[model samples]
Target: MTLTNRQRAVPPSMFADETLMELPPPVRLTGIGLRFYVDDEGRGSATPALIRGQLWPLDTAVTDATIREHLRALVKVGYIETYSINGRKLLALTDWPSVDRGSRSRLPAPPSTEPLARSSRASRETFAVEGGGEEGREDGREEGAGEGGRGPSRDARDETEPSPFCRKHQPHGTDFACGGCASARKRHDQWLRAEAEAEAEGLAE
Candidate 1:
């Protein structure tokens, strides 16, 4: 898959999403990494071996099982959906397009041994679901099953839900701060540090 090497937009709501806020930090970071690495379609393989090999120099004490558990946690929280293709697992981020505020691309049809695999034509059909911000079912079938399967519910409260961090702005993600409020705080801290450093230099002279 050809992935764009540009900065992906991470909504502040991600930090506030009840689904994400409850996850362990490593899992949350992994989810963010997934967004960065995957194609616009949010298609990628996050097998334990790949994650361990690629996800930076983590402590050796953290076993593959732990990583797998984190991946499962992401799935459970509705941030990702997993599909089995030819005995291999493929994951798709459910809310990527919404978070990026762009049109989602069609998933490349996988070569599959399973009969559930769709034809090329069907695969090209857009997988866009209305209100894709909601949590998927516990079973992990966000799009539902069979001909009559009722898919998971959309996050109706995404717009209406107030962020815990900012009253005016919805929740967003940041390394140290959230949205506008946290960014303001960061700038304020930097200004204070610069002032303090200048004062110390003058006193020494």
Candidate 2:
């Protein structure tokens, strides 16, 4: 993935749009983030599992159902258009070229042709909900926590695997940075520091 120096734009009309205003906070935020990471043509692959992983931090336990519901909300708002190509669901942001001129260099185009095999995964997906679990639970075993004398699953604890982008913007089936994540991390750290300083000041008084 090539990193462009151009930052994503947020039009003033976004706040003015009646449809956007009616969306729930989670759905609205997710829609805006999607526009930032989608390809020049505003196309991207999204499954509930993929959305849960890429849209939220690893710790957040948003259910697939929840993600699907928000995606449906985006569709209702006309912010997204979904179609199937080769058994994969693809999303396109409507009128994307109007908002962003996009990269001059061609990236991989969205899948447009039929394939020999249809995906076994249903075109309309169904995901099993993890019942009674709190949101944002870490995927790996906590340090020194044990269960039935067995360690955490090896796959869960592995850290040697490098994610191409920061967890938030990493795309499914791809592992490469587009330089979008650095700004996010910087803002996060700044917020944390500000909170810490405010707490310190409060105690001092």
Candidate 3:
């Protein structure tokens, strides 16, 4: 992938540095490949790259196959996922999936983000009052944790995963209103509605 202005700031030491001088060339290639996902910009980006112009005089001699070799190793390790876009092979750091930095942090996974904590609690309360277990327990744990600040804190985790109030644990699909939409909507439902909404909005524009 090509380096963006932001990614260009990365130092060559993060990629091709003295650590290579100590290892056999093949091992060094593997090290660089392993680091593909660890580099700050790479970890924070869907597309990560070696700055074409920034690597240094020592980096010029590297071959495309060698880079690809390293990339393959990284792919095997779940460091990044390699795919082709527009017929050119591109690398995405799956460890840090989003291209948006506003969405990334050091957490193992994103935190639960429920839009309306009170509403989830109300739902949980109703579920409990109506003799529901799975729905109320799951929602209550989420809502209560959210309300009491017991769940993963914003400062402590990413906010891009399934919400803590996910209704999937509810005993029956009938429990949640079919027409209601939440950011935490049942997995397939959210995707369907959002896809349709995006399509509609695109057509409107």
lDDT of each: 0.52, 0.51, 0.38
Cα lDDT of candidate 2 equals 0.51
Tens-digit lDDT track for model 2 on 111-186? 3222211221121011112311344123542332224212222342233223333443445422332222332333
Supply candidate 3's per-residue lDDT for 85.
39
How much is the lDDT of residue 11 in candidate 1?
Answer: 75
Question: Using Cα atoms with residue i matched to residue i, what is each candidate's TM-score against the true structure?
Answer: 0.46, 0.46, 0.29
Which regions of candidate 3 are displaced past 4 Å?
Answer: 1-57, 97-205
lDDT (10s digit) by residue, model 1, range 1-205: 3234546777787777655775788888877877776666567776776665556445686567977887788776556667776777777665545435544544443332123213321321233243233553334433532222332122321232223333323345344333334433433344445444433433454
User: How accurate locally is residue 171 in candidate 2, as Cα lDDT from 0 to 100?
Assistant: 53
**Highest lDDT among the candidates is held by which one?**
1
The TM-score that candidate 1 achieves is 0.46
Model 2 spans > 4 angstroms off: 1-6, 98-101, 104-205
